[model samples]
Target chain A: MAIIDLNNVSKSYVSGFLMRKKKAVSNISFKVGNGEILGIIGANGAGKSTIIKMIQGFIRPDKGDILIDNNKPFDPASRIKMGYLPENPYFYTNLTAVELLRFSTSASGMPKQLADKRIKTLLETVDLYPHRKQRLKTYSKGMTQRAGICFALVHDPQVVVLDEPMSGLDPLGRKMVLDLILDLKAQGKTILFCSHILNDVERVCDRVAVMDKGHLRKVFTREDLGNQTMEEVFLHTIEERSEC
Target chain B: MLNKVLSLSILTFLEGVRDRAIFGIGLFALAMMSVTLVVLGFFMRELDKVAVDINLSAISLAGLLVTFFLSINLMAKDIDKRTIYCVMSKPFSRAQYVWGKYIGILFIISTAFAVLTFCSSLTIVIAKMQYTNWFKAFSWIEYFKAVYASFLMFVVLNAFIIFFSSITSSSFLTLLFSICTYIAGQTIEEVVIYLKSANGQEAQLSEFIQKMIDILQYILPNLSVFDLKVQASHAIHLPLDYLLAITGYAAIYSGILMIAASLMFSRRELP
Candidate 1:
């Protein structure tokens, strides 16, 4: 079953003093099935973040519908089982990792004892257990990214949406996140992963969707890639479209 | 629903309390109160009145600073910094987000008031002990009532701040609008009264100006009604009915502003 769906969605943003409407996404539609890992790869301004925001109900679509677990994106119930990590996740700097996780669990209605256990485990998984008591303001960018990972997973959500999850991470941190994604996949959680790292996308994703200039140019599974590298296929697809 | 709101409120409160600016405001208020004690020596008569006025003014001034600085930052900066993405992803509606943030700001204001009140009470006690004769007319009940009224003013003012924050895209604009609203709300009553006086009528203000002032009297909050400083300084008794009326007025005004803010915020697109 499709746990997340978007049908013919379109969005445009008005900018500058003239109030000119610039199209961000035009007539885009796709879905991630239950327990499936789908990766979205695109250059900057390709409407990748816009689609993620629409799915999370942060921004409404200019046209068409988006549903999570059969509920409209605007409904709070649609997000009850969702976890999201933004491109550069910024949290309240005054809060410690534990406090931030505690907030996430409480907001998600997790029982206190269970939440405590889960928070500790997630922090440890991200190698942030030693610094759990440190304020987020004091954390380095890489450390903050790791903390954000813990925050998104603390409630053990059914659907995880990560945008540029590996942006600020070091190689070690990237490996940890890759392992974590694989772990989440093993747990049968549906994942919508957006990243610029083609190698990582090729390694972890069941299917990779290539977006260019606000349009989904191609969605090819691992089998479709066959012996071709994700880098090759992505460049070929973009160049192929630009040639037309 | 309550759980989600409460969680957000607690998170906001924690974030607010830990801000370094709160400490600066607290220190400034304390310094003002301490200066009041030294200035009291210069007043030969009505020393009690001087002390009461200064203490109450210190609390009110500190509250205004908090609303202008910390409260605006708490709500408006979420969107400015994009920290709101982490928050809006939770299973809470935009209305819940507004109410939760409002409640959290109230908690911050209440905590600041509580600390300031305690310090002001200590200063008043010292003043009373040092000059017991002047304090003969000072009633604790009247003093506390003034503080309560001042707090209500902040409640209404914070609602306006939230309302402005919802409409304005930037924190600076929200601060500007809030300060303007407060200034208008504070002086609109006095302006109307002056225009109605016989001497004022002699100036022969235009009909358009008179009509505008009249409309403004109803539109802007009558914040002067919440000023009980003179009554407290003189130990004049306030009727129970008047207290109840202002309390009701604060509740209604804040309630309406919050509802409007929530509606406006819900329609806003988070980019």
Candidate 2:
């Protein structure tokens, strides 16, 4: 069964009365099988994050439904099987990185004995363990993003959804996050990531889906993105959106 | 599901405590109740009832003011700063988030009320020698009616502020609307009073006022029910029905407002 599936899904936002509702994702349909690293590329406001939101159950689609492991993705049971790292994720600044990780995993239903052990593992997984005791407010952007990813995966979910997970990282931090994604993929975890940074997507994503103005413009593989750099492919898809 | 609600709500409580902004407002409110000593001597003739009324008025004002201000700012800032997306991405539902925030704000407001009420009572007692013996000299019912009801009213006031904040996107608007509701809601009894004047009956003004009163009483909470000071001051027994009615209304009204807020937040697209 597909790990994540969107069938004729649509979402729109009403600005106010008498104004037309802007459709963010319209009749978007796609399926991601288990263990697939699917990278979604889009310009700003291109509905990439909207797909992740629907899958995360953060926002309900106006039409259609999403399935995770052949079950409704938004159900709490499905959420238990998935992990998500939001773009520019924010956390409780008062908590130390370790404390926050412990809290997140506990909230995800990890047993206390197991949660403590996993916290140690995740700290090393994201390379934030060196500064794990420090409060979040003191961390750099890349550090925070790494911690955010740690929180998402603390439960060892089957599918991980990451939106711009490595956007603000330094070269070293970016490389660490990429290596982590590859590691998670190797562990048989499916990943759906959205980013404008095509190089990282090209390096890690086994498959690629380009979205534009709420439409699924194209879906291809590494070879397709390789036919031209992801930047060239992304620019071409964006231009196609503008033309339509 | 209840655990989800409770866990998320606890975060709201902790977040409210960590906000640091509420501390300043809370201290200021405490000082306001302390300063009511001067306010008491000025109204000393009626002493107890007037003191209870004005002091509760101060507490209701502060609790409503802060709850309305804080809830909106907290929710909006979290979203603006993108902290909420991370939290929401967990197994937490949006409604759970809203309810959790409301619960946290309520905890803060409730604690603030306890502190302010103690200060207000102390202020009232220290103002005059006659006031110190005031409670014991009378039926214990007076203080229970006056002071206990005052605290209860503060709870209702928090409910009002929180409910308003849940629906209104802007904190300022929520604060303004809540204040208007508090002030205008209090004045409704007087409007109803004028309706029964029988003197205003000749002018046909009584019917209009009555109609206005009915509409407002239905739409806005009857804050007067929570004001037991008048009965206390007169040493009249407070009807248990009044307090029960106020609490019942608070539960129903706050629930409606929260439901409305959850509906709004569920549709909100986090930026």
Candidate 3:
């Protein structure tokens, strides 16, 4: 069974006094199977994050259905096995990195001893252990991103969703995050990530989902790569969808 | 659910404490309290009244600053910064978020009041020592009661802030709405009393004006009910039933506001 599923989900946002309606995601549908690493690739404003939001139950779909663990996204139980890291995530600046991790782990119902142990390990893994005592406000952008990653994974969720996880990271940080994603994949965890970096997606994703102008243009597997790279396929699909 | 709410509440409280505005307001309140020393000297026979009035007003003004600056900023920051996306993605409902934030702001306000009231009480004590004979009628119990009521009033005001934060997209608009609520809430009872007296005297209240006052009395909080400062300052005996009734009023009104905030926030979409 798919751990994350969206069947014809659509969302529109109204703006301004005139209530001008803008379609954000249109009839978007996909499924992330257990232990599958799926990457969503899109340009800016291509509705990648919107799909993640729906899967995480942050927003309701205007039409169609969304299911996590075979339950509606609106159900808290449906999110029991899910973890999410938003783009450029900001945490409570007053909290140390460890404190934020503790909060996250506790929210997931981890007992004190177990949560503390996991927090120690995760901070070490992300190379933030040395600075975990410092408030999040004092951390650099890359450090904050790493903390956000730790926050998402602290609960040891079976399905992880990350939006633009590599956007603000340096070369080394990007490499570290990519290795972490690969590590999670090896652990048999299902991962769904949104990114603009085609190479990183190709490296870690079992399948790639392309979005263009709020529409799912194509879903490509490793076998479908053939001689064409993800960038080429991505551009072609977007151009084809635009022409249509 | 309780765990989530508690965690969020703790985080919110910590964040509020770290904010420079709280420190700034704390200092501002202390400075205002010190001014009572100078202001008290200006009055001869009513030194106790001046001290009580200044001290209570300082606490009230401090509460306003925390509500308008710290509490509003906390709620609005989460949304405007999109940090709420991280929070909302957890196993929490919108109502949980609202309750957690409201409780956290209450904690900040309560702590601020505790400290300020302590300082204010000390000020009153120092003044009492200087004029031992004149402060014969002063009651510490009454003064504390006034502070408690003032705290309850701010609790209701913070609820209004939460409701506004849930509905409005911009913090500025939330601030504006909350301030307007505060202004209207503070004066609506007085307006109602005036209109009623005018009606009794046949002094002519327009039907529209009378209707507006009636609507405002119900819509806006009757904050004046919480003003026990005059009674405290004068050492008047306050009925126990009145204090209990106002406490109940604060709880029910805040509860309703929270429910409304949760409902509105749940329906809201994040950008």
Candidate 4:
């Protein structure tokens, strides 16, 4: 069964100061099935983050429907079962990693005992146990991103959405994040991610969605994507869309 | 759902604690309050003259510094630091996020008021020594009224900033609007005084301005109403009916501003 669905959804934003109208995502639609890792690739301003924001309900779209496991995705209640890691995640810099995780748990309403256990295990899972008590302001970019992932998974939600999760990292840090995604997949979790790093997405995603000009350009599994690179596939699809 | 709001409030409180800049701000505010003692000790003959003015003025000034300047800048710091997006993405509603932030910032303002009031009253004690019996403390009741009044003033000010911060993309506009609110709130009495006087040219203009001002006087939160410094300094007795009515007015005004702020926040989009 599909775990995530966007049917005929559209979003437009009116610029606050300029009063200019912008159609961020126009009639966009796709799905991610249970236990599937779907990767989305697009350039900046391609409505990648806008779609994520809509799915997270930070901003409601103007029209159509979005369902997470057949439930309203934009409702606050549906968020309890979903975990999202934003690109360039922000933290209370003065807080220790442990404290941030604890704060997230309290806000998410996870039981205190379970919250503690999860924090402990997740810190170790991310290899952040050594810096758990250090202030986040002192952490490097990679370390902060790791802490971001830890907070996202603190509730052990059924669906995990990560936007550019591996962007700010060295090779080893990227490897660690890629391994984390695989680990989550191994445990039967449904993962949705968007990336500019095509190689990273190619290695982990079971299926891939390419978005361009506020629409889904194509959906392909690893085999259909094949040894042909993401750029070549993206080029072919954009050319097809333009011609049609 | 409400539990999330409560928990976020606590987190907001803790986040304020973590800022550490507020501690330095508190100390500076308290220092000014204590400086009044030095000035009062220098002019021991006019002790009561200085004590009443200094103590009451210190509360408003300290509260103005914190609530006017600090509260307006608080959200700016979170935005500059990009920490706002994380909080917004949680299961928390925008109303909860904004109210939590407002309440947390208010906690800091209240603390600043308390410390400043304490230091100011201590000056009152030392200054009142020469005026009254040997080394006897004058009275805390008057100072208590000042503190309570200042607390209300800060709440309105905090709400004012939070409301503007929601709709304004520019911190400069937000700060300017807060200052305008402050000036408008302070001049309401003078505006009313000019309203009733019978004159020809100026009065016609004044009355038109006065009518508009009268509408603003009730519509905006009145900083002057919460200001009991007149009685505190002049040792004049304030009417109980007027004071209570003003407090009730503040409560209603603050509620409307906060509800409007919540509505604006609900429609905000985060990057």
Candidate 5:
């Protein structure tokens, strides 16, 4: 069954003094079935982040529908079992990692004993246990990204949405995140992963969706790639669409 | 729902208290209170009255600074810095977020007021001890009433801040609107009084102008109601009914503002 669904979703935004409307996403739709890792890849302004934002209910769609576990995106109850990490994740800088995670757990209604245990484990998993007491303002970009990961997963949410999760990570950090994504998939969690790096997306995602100029150009499973690498397939697909 | 709001509120409070600006404001208020002692010596005749006025003014000034400087930043920073994304990703409605943040700001204001009240009370006590004759008319009950009213005024002012923040994304704009509202709210009562008096009638204001003023009086808060400094300094006890009336006014005004803020905020597109 599909745990995350977007059916004929469309969104537009108005900007500047003239109030010109720019179509962000037009009638785009897809679904990530239970325990599926679906990667979304596109250039900037291709509506990749817009789709993620719509799914998270941060912004509304001008038309169509979105559901998380069959509940409307705008409803708070829909996000109860969801976790999200945004591009260049910005958290409250004055709070320490432990304090932030505790807030996440507490907001999700996690009990004290279980929350403490999960916080410790997640911090340790991300190799941030030693600096857990330091304020986020003092953390480096990579450290902040790791902390964001801990924050999203602290409540043991069943559906996870990640946008540009690998942007600030070092090679070792990237491997850790990749491992974490794979580990989450093993745990039967539905994941919507959006990233610019084709290689990372190809490695973890069961299927990859390619977006171009605010349209879902193609969505293909790993088996559909045949002998072609993701880089070759992606270039061919984008160039082919541009040529037409 | 309450639990989620409480969690967000606590987060906002912690963020507010840890700000370096808050510490600076606290120090400034304490220093002002300390200076009151030395300043009191100059007003030999009305020492108690001057002391009460200065102490209360210090509290009022501190609150204004926090509302404009610290509290506005706390509320606006979430939207300005895109931190709202992380917060809204959880099981929280936008309305819950607004209420939680407003309550958190209240916590910061309450803590600052509590500390300043303690320091101000101590200063008043020392002044009274040194010049018992001058403090003959001073009443502790009236002094506390003035402080309570001032705190209530801040509660209303913070609601205005939240309402402004919901409409605009810029913190600077929020501060500007709040300042204008504060100035207007403070003086609206006096303006209405003058307009209704014999002097105002001599001006022969047009019907349109008079109607506009009337509408504004009902719209903008009658902040003068919260000013009990003169009465407190003179030890003139206010009636219990009057106190209850203002309390009810603050409650209703703040409640309406929060509801409006939540509605505006919920409709906003988090770009």
Candidate 6:
């Protein structure tokens, strides 16, 4: 069964005094079934983040319906079992990583004793145990990213959504995140992620969805990829869509 | 839901208390309190009035500074820095965000007020000890009444700040609107009274202008009503009924403003 579904979702942003409407995503629809890793590959303006925001209910779709656990995206109940990490995740600079996680646990309604155990384990998993007491303002980019991942999983959410989780990381940092994603997948978690790094997507995704100019061009599965490089597949897909 | 809001509120308060601006404001209030000693030394005849006026003005000035500088930043920084994205993605609604943030700000404002009031009252005591004869008519109860009224005024001001924070896209705009609201709220009653007196005279003011003033008076908060420092300084009789009435006025006005803010914020799209 699908844990997350977006049926014909459409969203547009109006900008400037003239209110010139720009279509961010148009009638895009897809779903991530239970225990599946779906990687969305898109360019900067291809509406990947827009879709994530709608699914997270930070904004509403101009048309269509979004269901997380068959509940509307805006419903707090819909987000109860979900975790999200935004691209370049920013947090309260004044708060330490441990404090931030404590806040997250409370917001997710986790019991205190359980949250304490989970928080320690998650912090250790991200190799941030030593820096847990430092303010987020004092953290390096890699440290902050690791702390962000821990925050997302602090409550042991069943479905995790990560937007550009690999951004601004060195090879070692990227590898750490890649390994974390694999670990979550191994634990039978449903993961939906968007990344510009096609190689990482190819390496980790069960099925890869290519988006271009607010449209979902294709969703390529592992069997379909065979030995073809994701770069070639992604380029060919974009070319084919442009020609059509 | 309450737990989530409380967590956010506590987080916001923690962040606010750690801000350098808040520290600076606190130091400034402290410095102002110290200056009251010197200012009172210069006034021999009206020592009691000088002490109350200087101390109360210090607290009010400190509050205004915090409202414009610190409180506005607390609300706008989350949105500006995109930190709001992570918080909003939680199992909480945008209305909860607004209320949580508002509650946090209230905590900060109240904390600051309490500290400053304590310092001011201490200075007043020192001055009273120095000039025992001058404070023969002074009353501590009346002084606390003024402080309580000032607290209510700030509650109303912070509500206005939250309302503007929800509607405006930029911090500068929020500050601008809040300043305008403060000025209008502080003086609109006097403006209406002026217009009424002019109306009694022959054709001094136009009906349209009078009508506009009347409308403004009805909408804008009468912040002047919260100013009991003069009466407090003089130890005048302030009826309990009047205080209760103004307190009710503040509650109803701030309640409406908060509801409006929550409604506007719930519809706001995060960038």
Task: Note the DockQ of each predicted structure.
Answer: 0.91, 0.44, 0.71, 0.58, 0.88, 0.81
Q: Rate residue A187 of model 1 by lDDT.
A: 98
How many pairs of residues in model 2 come into backbone collision?
Answer: 0
Model 6 Cα shift for residue B2 (angstroms): 1.6
Compared with the true structure, what per-residue lDDT tens digits does model 1 show for residues A176-235?
999999999999999999999999999899999899999999999999997899999999
Off by over 4 Å in 2: A15-18, A21-23, A62-64, A92-103, A124-140, A223-228, A235-244, B36-57, B76-82, B118-141, B144-151, B154-168, B198-219, B231-236, B259-271
Estimate, for each residue in A131-177, the C-alpha lDDT of model 5 and write its tens digit. Answer: 99999999999999999999889999999999999989999999999
Model 5 C-alpha lDDT versus the unseen true structure: 0.92
lDDT of 2 at B4: 62
State model 2's lDDT: 0.74
RMSD of each predicted structure: 2.0, 4.0, 2.2, 3.2, 1.9, 2.2
- Considering only N, C-alpha and C atoms within 3 Å, which residue pairs clash in candidate 3? none
Q: lDDT for each of the candidates?
A: 0.93, 0.74, 0.89, 0.78, 0.92, 0.89
How does the DockQ of candidate 6 come out?
0.81
| Higher-ranked by TM-score: 3 or 4 | 3
Question: Model 4 misses residue B142 by how many Å?
Answer: 1.3
Which residue pairs clash in candidate 2? none
Candidate 6 regions with alpha-carbon error over 4 angstroms: B199-218
Ranking by DockQ: 1, 5, 6, 3, 4, 2
Our tally of clashes for model 6 stands at: 0
Query: Per-residue lDDT for B144 in model 6?
Result: 90
Off by over 4 Å in 5: B200-218
* Displacement of the residue B99 alpha carbon in candidate 4, Å: 1.9
Interface RMSD (Å) of model 4? 1.9
| 2 against 4, candidate with superior lDDT | 4
Descending-lDDT candidate ranking: 1, 5, 6, 3, 4, 2
* Top-DockQ candidate index: 1
- What is the overall TM-score of model 4 with all chains considered together? 0.90
